[model samples]
Target: MSEMMTRENLTGLYVITDTTRFQRAALVESVSEAIAGGARVVQYRDKSDDVARRREEAAALAELCRRHGRSFIVNDDVALAIEVGADGVHLGRDDAPLTETRARFAAEGLDAIIGVSCYADRLRAERAAAEGADYLAFGAMFPSPTKPHAPGAPAEVLGWARERLGRPVCGIGGITATNVRDLMAHRPDMIAVISEVFAAPDIRAAAEALCHAMAADNTESIQTTEDPETS
Candidate 1:
């Protein structure tokens, strides 16, 4: 793990900021609430083409997450991640290659976490791991407001990934307190959320709920594994 994903155990709520819902100023407040509520991971995910605005918002968010001791990531923007001194970058199919990103991080002397979005393709995830990605994210587990047209991934993938990759597997897309159980059944290392955390009326409450769910799920998994009869 390139020091980018500094967490030894990358399990729990991963909050993503939505530009549409949280303005630049409001982004800090909402993200702070998420941090207070126990969100350990945050991603600055803005799809806008406005480089200046993105730089400004991402810088602020990176600083905010740093203050909370959380991993701050830039979505699909290597340049911005480097500029903001982010923990890492999350890349989609359209983004630069994972190998390139890894090499770039090294060249820049930055400890960076390189996360790849596998969507629903297990083969792609396998390839990503082989290529040195720190973590794999798969999602659209349910109907998602963030990516309404995204294809849904089976929860089983999370379990398979955890076993196969031997690294953190993040489940994303429409994950909330209500539907998170399905994903949790697989014991994913993390679950990424956009609107649920940033757009909620009470950001702290929403994040807390998700955090509690993940902790409970992880604890259950540990207990089950350690049980003599189950073993």
Candidate 2:
């Protein structure tokens, strides 16, 4: 991981969610619970075209993350991220290029943290690193309810990315406590979750359990495995 990402001392849980799924009270409640359960990053991803609402939700999430001493990231909208004074923004491939994104944030004096979604391609991951993205994410590792039709990324790609990108790498999609063990060997800097936390019956416990699994010591076990599918 780059010294920039490592400097934050962030590990384990990162939560991404939409505003409609969580009202004000529920959003605050869930965030409080997740932070208490060890979430170090909270990403607000609202795909709606309603700019006003997106701004509102981003501001709220940024405030919550700030209160908890965690990083707040706005998904897909660099403008909204700046408007809300968020810690950073997460960009998809189709979004603004990292160079432009960084320049925009820097112009605003934000020093924004930028993360790119590289899916499962090593080349794309390498490109993101070269572009100075603070982190790179891959997955839909399992059947994710948020994006069910999204193809899964191989678990071992995490190792390939860790070696090449040298930046914090995140695994997203259908991550959960039960199957997260599959990703342990890759040693990602963190895991980005959606329904696993908000949709859980007990958000706090679910967050805690997932963080524990990610933090478990399984380096030897994963390396010894004979999965030719992995790099």
- For all predictions, the C-alpha RMSD in Å is 4.6, 3.6
Alpha carbon lDDT of each predicted model: 0.83, 0.79
Against the true structure, candidate 1 reaches a TM-score of: 0.91
Please write out the lDDT profile of model 1 over residues 110-171, one tens digit for every residue.
76888899998888998999998888999889989878999998887787778767878999
**Worst lDDT 10-window in candidate 1:** 222-231
Candidate 2 TM-score, C-alpha based: 0.89
Q: Tens-digit lDDT track for model 2 on 64-148?
A: 7776678888888888888888878899978988999999988887677888898877678888899898888999788889888
Q: Model 1: runs farther than 4 Å from truth? A: 1-9, 221-231
Q: Candidate 1: how many backbone clashes? A: 0
Determine which window of 10 residues in candidate 2 has minimal summed lDDT.
1-10
Top candidate when judged by TM-score against the true structure: 1
